[model samples]
Target: MIGAPMETKGLNANRESKPNRSRKEIIEKKKAMDALLKAASAEKDHLSAFPAFRRYQTNGLSAFLESGRGDKLASSVKHYIQNLLKANMEGLYGSEWPVEERVKRREMVAPEARYIFVREASNASASEMSTMSEQESTSASCVEKRGPMVGFVHFRFVIEEELPVLYVYELQLEPHVQGKGLGKFLMQLIELIARKNQMGAVVLTVHRSNSVAMNFYLSKMRYGLRRVMKFFAKHSVMRLKLSWRYVSVSTRNHLRRFIWFNKVVNSTLFTKGQNPAIEVLEWIIQFQQNALIIVI
Candidate 1:
């Protein structure tokens, strides 16, 4: 009878120990799964590195992607962007933003940034081309021989709303190159890169006072305005949705505006007593309205 009681106690202890062992095994499996996910993410980032060379035949321009954690290169890019912004957005930002301070801030964040430089390709010397096997070295020398830098696009890959996107921080070109369709070419290249990397969208912010830029993005490129926030109080966020085809409805609207302007210009009322300056002001107001249609 005493042996029976002892056997029952032994069975109860074995049952309790089984649950503990099962719990430990479950914990181990969960940890392993977490580690595997982390490793896979890192591998994907490594594999998705941007290509060093891209050529746009329409503009006779070639762009090279410079990506790394190098501070010197980042500084150079920051300086370039700063010059561009000072010329383009100084009025929009007003006197509150000093160029030097803005450049400093950009430099601090640039180590994590990637730059696409517009360069001309030079026929490399035979000896240098034959001796260089490393792509990095080849690119560095190519930049040196390719003459002065004409323009650059600074962008980064980011996750927004749980989707991967390419964010364009700045796209700047020299005054001589501005009207030659290079800006559109650069944006096209950015979209292509985003698509190649499986990004969902391309996003950028434009200053409200920069009407030319706003028109280029909305009417020319068909980027839809996502939202207008008071954070900057003077900027609008624009996004190009990559999942759908972009219709040229905006183009048709612009054509209609042009036709209306021509009709008004030819009208007797416009020529009889109305001042020419008044007509110009009317046209400007209409243009502004068209640009703001997508804002809010």
Candidate 2:
């Protein structure tokens, strides 16, 4: 036993069973990663996130963008992007912080940004079909860091029965871009667009796990009408159906158009060119003040 090499316990383990060392550890890590992925789904397409997602895990999609117009329950996620620029949720070292916030603190966050607008058909009534996949529609809008896309809130609307049923696509904000109330602002901005377009009410969907978004949408009491119901068995979809009255151009009659969100949230938002959905959210928040307090 004198010459007996001090068997490297872990090294021996690796030598004999490197590939099968720890199933328990592997499973737990997998679960943690899945939850992280689920939590970070909204930010899958961030500019800084691209390299990390691609090289770190080799997991990503081509739809990946620096940023794009987000879901249209009435919002401009561009606002979300701007706010995320200051999300002070974390730091880089000593302790792990939100990937984006840490990136922001050091000024390492990619200034690389893009806006995905709801590319609506110029004329939905046109004779041409937009997509071959059973009328699956798409949108195209200018991408700008400056303000060419000002005044008008670029929105995406789908016309049904000659009435525009707006499409609220999913939102993606990188971990580097969380916090700073961009989420709420995005919701309000979308409603602003809906108010302007003379389109029907706004409709959007939130995943069950996305408590942050659900809470924001639920914050609008008027928005939680039948459209914002628990109707879906597994997931929930909120539809904001508006009357022709709300879509009026005067913008003064704007608040009057809000049949549901009326007197809810910030009814003051009913003012000209204001986002009626914000009032709805306010209303919803008031109805269930404690509801929003408690995480779903």
- Which one wins on lDDT? 1
Question: Which lDDT tens digits does candidate 1 get at residues 1-296?
Answer: 99999999999989999989888965764465344333423332221344423433334443333333224465665566566767765666666457534553554355445556765444453224334433643465565765455677766665433234566767777776676677887777677666555554566666556677767787777665533333233322332321211111111111211110101111111221122333332443456432222222
Candidate 1 weakest ten by summed lDDT? 258-267
Q: List where candidate 2 sits over 4 angstroms from the true fold.
A: 1-155, 160-162, 220-222, 225-296
Q: Which candidate should be chosen as best, given TM-score against the real structure?
A: 1
Candidate 1 — which pairs collide?
none
What is the lDDT for 105 in model 2?
Answer: 29
Candidate 2 lands at a TM-score of: 0.29
